[model samples]
Target: MISSFLLPLLLWSIERILKRKQFGWFIVIVTLSLVNNFYFAYYQLLTGLIYFLLELFFVINTIFYQEKVQSNVLSLPHYWH
Candidate 1:
């Protein structure tokens, strides 16, 4: 239960310290943790699954939208006086 809350924060801290994006770690850790929850009680498994999906959606959306914005900016023409 505690791991579910802490892993994201741990990943975020690692990314921040390294000054690099770490989506791969985020996906793997979250997926495994959620999958492990299924071995426990039913309620924990259900809530963990829901939370994992929501977090995955949010992370994926942020990555896609951020890339889209970056691409648009890069494609814009530069002006010189």
Candidate 2:
């Protein structure tokens, strides 16, 4: 029960801090946990899927938003010139 929740968070946190760029892989494993739930785990597929998708969205938003911010920062001086 608890392990299911903790496992994904552990993976996501490690990837987020270490590789950082490839944190999407954490989402993939968590998504697989959706299937794992159906095989007698305490949670349901919907719960696992929802959690995975939420985490995936957060990771993607972080990466893409940082990219946009960086590009805008780079372009700031160009607009004045």
Candidate 3:
């Protein structure tokens, strides 16, 4: 029982360490893992899908925005140099 709580906490700490370089993907995986484990082992559905959906949206937005900026940079002359 105690390990169950400790497990997610440990995974969460690891996820935090990787946050800046791979923010959304890590969060999604960790959150989903926690949700699955807790649900299957403890029969608890903690945390709402709304928050997950928001994280997904933010990730998508960030990717799209970055791509747009890259494309704009490519369009400028001498950008490759």
Candidate 4:
């Protein structure tokens, strides 16, 4: 029952920790959630992914594709390789 309220905070925390690159907490939260219930764990991550994409689109204030791809240019080689 309590999970209903706490789930949003926990799910959003996944985004905060990830946005800041805290992999340790990310793993801990995901593992803890997964251990409790698979359905919840799935929803938590699913919700987090949706929130992340929404935030990504809204937070960026760019008009050109070049601007968006500029920062990622350096990492493209690694991804391609």
Best by lDDT: 4
Ranking by lDDT: 4, 2, 1, 3
lDDT for each of the candidates? Answer: 0.59, 0.61, 0.55, 0.70
Q: What is the clash count for each candidate, in the order shown?
A: 0, 0, 0, 0
List pairs with backbone clashes in candidate 1. none
Give candidate 4 regions above 4 Å deviation.
Answer: 62-81
For 32-56, candidate 2 gives per-residue lDDT tens digits of 6555563533354345456657777
State the lDDT of candidate 1 residue by residue for 1-81, as single tens digits: 655564555446445434465566555655566566644334544554566567678878999999999988877765321
Off by over 4 Å in 1: 1-40, 78-81
Would you list the clashing residue pairs of candidate 4? Answer: none
Rate residue 67 of model 4 by lDDT: 74
In terms of lDDT, the poorest run of 10 residues in model 3 is: 40-49
Per-residue accuracy of model 4 over 33-61 as CA lDDT, tens digit each: 78878898789888878877777776564
In candidate 2, position 48 carries an lDDT of 46
Give the residue spans of candidate 3 off by over 4 A: 1-46, 78-81
